[model samples]
Target: MKKFFTILGILILVLVFVGTAVFLFNKSKEKPVVYETSSPFITDIIQKTVATGKVIPRKEVNVTSQVSGVVDQLFVDAGDTVAKGDIIAKISLAPNMIALNNAESQLESAKISLSNAERELERQKNLKAQRLVSESEYNKFLLDFELKKERVKSAENNLLLIREGSTLQSDLVSNIIKATSDGMILQIPNKEGAFIVESSTFGSGTTVATLADMNDMIFEGMVDEAEVGKIREGMELLLDIGALDSEPFQAELEYISPKGQQDQGTIKFQIRAAVKLQDQVFLRANYSANADIVLDKREQVLAINEGNLIFEEGAHFVDVETAPQQFERRQVETGLSDGINIEIVSGLVESDKIKQL
Candidate 1:
């Protein structure tokens, strides 16, 4: 009985040893999670928003045809500089057949009337020479002849104007299209054979070309309605043009639309900024660009990475490490943030280590 009890006691000891080893193995497998730490440093925080738009000239004029006709000649093309009153294109007048016929008929009728009056005047002159008619009656015949002569001349001139777009007594410029402003031609949509509409009281007409002063360029873009209110006129802007990567142009805000237009799902307000360009650098019209509007900025201020900040209620706070691997919740006063780093206004010193959340 004593031997059996000794064996039982040894087996119980073995089972107890196995349980202890299992517990030790599970305890060794557990791992602890750690976080990173950082400290505030002197940095620049530029808070800005980006607006996508295009670069365009400040003063642009569309050259349109004066008469409905086909394009006869184009003297200028895109990138050509022109002065005011310079001939940009010529139009071959497509005269209305019905109007031409009516004008011709009117001229013929006036000529017949003038011929009859001339005969009457000659007869009156003979009668007056014989004292067969009063001087007043002869004078009336002379006035009638003169009036009929003027009408014939007027109708002849009208017929010539309709057929040739110019009359012999006037300058030959009725079908000639001239530049109204001094600028560089940006576009010429009409070719030599393209039919163009005349800009009259009736229609806007076809745009022969678009001209503008490229020296005075502006960045035109739209901004979200939420961001438009924070911006005002005369604010500085930095433009990044996709075409010219090396040129960094600056601009001044000059216009902001009072109303908002719905685009996609958001309301946008159209804005324009005057681009200050260099003489050597040329900014072409309608180049896609992005405008970085600086809303606020801070130079060489105590700033921390925004990741270290924790928001509670409406205030901002951060987890500051007071001891080694030990952090405490501390309320911090923050300033401008460029989205990556936030300016630390108060609550922590340069030596305070901030833990990442």
Candidate 2:
């Protein structure tokens, strides 16, 4: 019985060893990896980088109140087209009590002074007409009376301006906020009765509305800091607005911020590109967009898939096909690369076949 058990265990060991040997031998005999071969082809290569941003009007004007007041009435809303000097909003003046009191007091004092001057002028005229006073003396009284009258008028205007936002001289254009340029209303941040701060030499005021020429739009976005050096102003850009998914818009690079901002563990630089408007297609302001900025371009050049090129010690080389299924290392000068295909500057021709790595 022990001999029978031993024989069975030996047979099992022999079967396992034979199976392992057969598996190992078959794996070793498997075919090696074979990459495809292709020759250089004539094609256009465009090297570009993408910047994510939004579509904005090239010129956006913020309409702010000249006086601290409440937005009493809004003349227009978003999407309303306005001409230059068109009223956008009306601001109700929030007059200061102290300033108003001072202006009124100043006006009253001027009125009293004017009355006294007029009475003195009457007496001086009588004396001059009867030849009791010299002509020079009468002229002095007349000049003083005129000056006092002018001061009274100025004080009255000043008082009126403090009480209301406008005087008699500016009643038509008073606290009515007008558009500085012709454009469509993009936004109305303040509603009726919303309190607002005045824009003064002291501080920036609250914006009542935002206006922009929708025809003159732009793509404002940011790019990674690593790709900024390859771009410059006036480069053509392909802008893809997230809102308008029909076709990509064309833009021209215009602004690149000198400073870089850190975001999500990476540095990005701001960029602005003017969008080229198309007919019958309206591009709303602040619509999100992505810009494809071309860094370089090669037209009708001999190029190959970038994967086939190998970089060694800063020099690029490709495997040129010597014969079927055989290749030889050949140094090649490269030019514009759009990441997928690269321009082969030298060491390869359109007819010379190259093997892929």
TM-score, candidate number 1: 0.83
Question: What clash count does candidate 1 reach?
Answer: 0
Model 2 regions more than 4 Å off: 1-43, 169-172, 255-269, 300-304, 308-336, 343-357
Shift in Å, residue 284, candidate 1: 1.7
The TM-scores, one per candidate, come to 0.83, 0.76
lDDT of 2 by residue, 39-139 (tens): 89999998889999888777889988888888889989898999999899888888878988998899999999999999999999999989999999999
lDDT of 1 by residue, 256-346 (tens): 9998999999999999999999778777889999999989889999998898889999899988887777888999999888989999899
Query: What residue runs in model 1 are displaced by over 4 Å at the alpha carbon?
Result: 1-37, 310-331, 347-353
lDDT value for model 1: 0.90
Model 2, 121: alpha-carbon shift in Å? 2.5
Estimate the overall C-alpha local distance difference test score of candidate 2: 0.88
Judging by TM-score against the true structure, name the best candidate.
1
